[model samples]
Target: MGSTHAPVDLSSEYAADFRAHQRTLRLGAMTVWPSTVQPLLSRRTAKLVRCSDPGTYNLTLVLEGTARASWDDREAEYRPYDLHSQNSWQPCTVQVGQNDQIVRCVGVEIPRNLVALPRNSADRAIGRPLSAREGVGALLAGFLTRLIADTSAYRATDGPRLGAVLGDLVSALFAHTLDSGRELSPEAHRRTLTLSVRSFIGRNLHDPDLTPSTVAAAHNVSTSYLYRLFQDENVTIGALIRRERLERARRDLADPAQHGVPVHEIAARWGFTHHSAFTRAFRAAHGTSPSDYRQARHQPTSIPERASGGTPTGSADQVM
Candidate 1:
């Protein structure tokens, strides 16, 4: 959640202790060492040490020379673009070669509450190692990259908005990692359904028969479920359709080309079957008749210009 950068010196004197110290850092934070040069002697000795707290969970992506991590009684070799994670407060040892290495990594400390899912669910979703090779991994990597790059622009005033963005990104990442598809969480599924329903409604705005049932059928969901999903948003499916149609008509009437088109034709084009109904609704929403509004918009320019004579006389049009 917070980040800072400092130069690190990994020499023989402090290398072992540093490794031991890293193993105890909190799980919720991660460190990224961009690039550093290693002395030849350290490479030959392979005296690199890395460790993390027992309750901490972290992910590391190696971008350079060979490196290995020891955890869970097993050692895993890391290659460029390779992702690795750990669950529980356990020690992890990482060995890197002497050649200059560059690595860009993100470490996440999973919260305690999140660690308490059903045994099998936890193991599959959170407790075990998760790879960032696809889907949510890709999204998280991109989001973190942008977050780190734009940290300065995200101020206290922008906390809620930024927090929402982060929360969505985390939800998406976890959902993909769990492989629960659309069945994982009700909120996640609702978000997806809402997006789909909105898209369907927008595309079918010109269809006069586009109703809640039709939209639900198009997405293979029941009309009741569709209504339930949008309940919290405080708008009904029927209202959305009417609003979209009126919006389209309002836009067309304001356009110069549609100036020559009849108001009723514009209404019909956007799926309004009855002109009188459309006019009444439009007036209620906009506080003006469509024709009057359109004419007012086309009022002439107020600037005046001088009239020109056929030719300029030598005496400047004087009576001389």
Candidate 2:
């Protein structure tokens, strides 16, 4: 590629048979690319930077294989699940893949100004491999993987919102990596914390013990602060937990493979240990009892379909 903003020289021992694949998603100002490439070496020279520098930063999360990157006299090797950053203005070299193995990675590109961190701190992070296996890095890595796996969950209008979320996660991860968490803007901190809390909730939805107090304690936040976070989103923490649980149970009820699974079992699977309580909650949300909802979905095709189509009748309120 020869564009000044994104120029690089590529070489490879398998040049004649080199292959690469990438699926890119552009959300507002940020772009994500999940890619797989054969063993190769790429270099960005000073002359290329002088031609034009877009003042962008690239964050790459290695999903497979081994690679090395160097910039500003610093060099580091990255293995699977590790992350590294690159500055567009810096001259750099990246050697990716090894022993005929293909390198798989997810790359995120955003304008430098979008990252809420000191320029020097951000620069210092370049070429240093960051661990994506835990902490904020783990959250960012999981978000990136899920975003790529199902971009369809979001609508076109969600581009800017999704981009902003990505930026917040990146900034939080970088700040944590630099031990500058206190430097994050108040808004960014709140957003990142909220995201972390939500992720924790999703992972523990099957635990009936999951609650606002437990969630707050798990994240080292006060219950009041956690309530404030959900208040900002116009939802109660308790309600969000119940909603997620009900949704999971509803999904299981509607799945044909789960037909043999009893309604009470489905309810228990999603944290609803009380059959009566589960029935009332499911009815309130879906407008049908669990047993009825399951039967309706499993009805013969010859049955006259309601306006809700395959969805159970009275559950038209459900989001498509």
Candidate 3:
């Protein structure tokens, strides 16, 4: 809302019944906000923009219902999975939801200077709907969704690094749209490519034939170039693949629902062709064999009693 961009004036015919839920995750200077809300019309007038311009850009991906945004004589309508952006320095209006329907979306806010695009070029993208169904946009959408879904998995120290990755992905998507991909800084390109390659590896971890060469080919980069991409990461491409596969297998083994499944079957499910090798790697990484790890994870412990119980105190005016 206004916390990321300029404050807006909001109204709705369904005002009496309006309600909203929003969860915010701070990623260093960037913020990820996932919200579900009733229908409303919001406007950021020139006066508001002048009074409070954080010099940031707000990118929104609609996950449900619909919305329309307009600024500088430009207007665009967005449906589920579609992306649209608004600049804090601009005056804009957004009408979300319809016929009392609820709207859901994830929004990202980053400093304008971090985008690695000229101010004018970036402004041209405001209020323009970008497709999040494929390419870098899809990758970004998935990254944001995962971040919001499991904020607890990341430590506070990971925020700035995560924000940099998001910024690189956003810059790449915008550059691709403007046919200026070549203009991105070398670091931005490298970071974006690294993220893309990691995402690809994650999706294909179940393929036993997956290797560094195959991964490079899939991304249209040479094997040597792929190695160079991960130079700063301190882990080779093959090691990264192996580590990810082992991590996935470890998670499955620990799931109580899969406890009845054989350890070898769990290993094979994550592309481990040899049970012995899987066992060795799992132990090296976790200090325990897969079976032992699963046993320890599934062990039950007595629950602690709550010191006190009462209704949670919070304001009903928690509007998104």
RMSD of each: 16.8, 5.2, 5.2
Q: Which stretches of candidate 1 lie over 4 Å from their true place?
A: 1-179, 300-320
TM-score of 3: 0.82
- What TM-score, over all chains together, does every model reach? 0.44, 0.89, 0.82
Give the lDDT ranking, best first. 2, 3, 1
Instruction: Return whichever of 1 and 3 wins on lDDT.
Output: 3
Q: Which candidate comes out best when scored by TM-score?
A: 2
Rank all candidate structures by their TM-score, best first, as comma-separated numbers: 2, 3, 1
lDDT per residue as tens, model 3, 145-259: 8877755446556777888888888888888788787878888998888888998999999899999999999988899999989998899999999999999998898778999
Instruction: Identify the superior model by TM-score, candidate 2 or candidate 3.
Output: 2
Per-residue lDDT of candidate 1, residues 131-213 (tens digit):
55544555455544544443433433344343333344444445556755453456545564565577667778989999999
Q: Provide the lDDT at 225 for model 3.
A: 99
lDDT of 2 by residue, 96-129 (tens): 9888999999999999899888878877677665
What does candidate 1 score on TM?
0.44
Instruction: Give lDDT per model, in order.
Output: 0.55, 0.85, 0.85
